[model samples]
Target: MKRTVITVDGNGMLSIPSNLQDLWMSEGELVDMLHVTAMKLHAVIRSIYKDGLLTVSEVQQKQETSNGIWQTLY
Candidate 1:
């Protein structure tokens, strides 16, 4: 995993770090991808807040299940 610090401006805008911006541009043309990713991240944060922290194995299991479902649907 990689980590970087970002600041929210007074106007509530966030500037994407340069490294991540490059990856996003290479991946697809859809700007909606960022919104979808943010929503998924919010869901994970909410789950942690409600249920407490998850163990690594528990997180991996959930990820596998999510990927399976996504693959099946796609």
Candidate 2:
């Protein structure tokens, strides 16, 4: 997993680095390109919570069923 230190300002705003922003933009573009809907993503999150644990394989399976594009990100 990639980790980065993020600091929140006194106003409660997070200061995201440019690289992170670029990464997020690319992810967004990919999601759009793949036609992944918000509801599909939410369903994946709900399934994870219903399982009461975070498992990488389970998440990948759920994502595969929901969007079929998450594996590419990994």
Candidate 3:
């Protein structure tokens, strides 16, 4: 697992890191659908926040799991 920080711009936009973009691009034809990928990623992040799954213990448990993206935002 790896960790990195993301920043939201003054206009409230979050830029997906190039490393992540490259990884996703290698996953298949998603290179042509980067916008959709970003949207889905944002939605997943929003859902995690909305669902109150950001607790320390929960985040740790998720990081232990074998699949999916588990992120905690301050």
Top-scoring candidate (lDDT): 2
Name every residue pair that clashes in candidate 2: none
lDDT of 1 by residue, 1-74 (tens): 23333435667687667674222221111223344564565576468856867643333311123245411100
RMSD of each: 14.4, 14.3, 13.3
User: What's the ranking of the predictions by TM-score, best on top?
Assistant: 2, 3, 1
The 10-residue segment with the lowest total lDDT in model 2:
21-30
Residue-level lDDT tens digits of model 2 in 4-72 = 334456666766665653222233333454468856755765688778877544333212324555532
How far out, in Å, is residue 6 in model 1? 2.7
Sorted by lDDT (best first), the order is: 2, 3, 1
What C-alpha lDDT does candidate 1 achieve relative to the native structure? 0.39
Give the Cα-based TM-score of candidate 3 against the true structure. Answer: 0.28
**lDDT, each prediction:** 0.39, 0.47, 0.45
> Between which residue pairs do clashes occur in model 1?
none
Q: Please state the error at residue 36 of candidate 3 in Å.
A: 7.0
Weakest ten-residue segment in model 3 by summed lDDT: 22-31
Residue 30 Cα positional deviation in candidate 3, in Å, after optimal superposition: 13
Residue 45: error of model 2 in Å? 0.7
Better model by TM-score, 1 or 2?
2
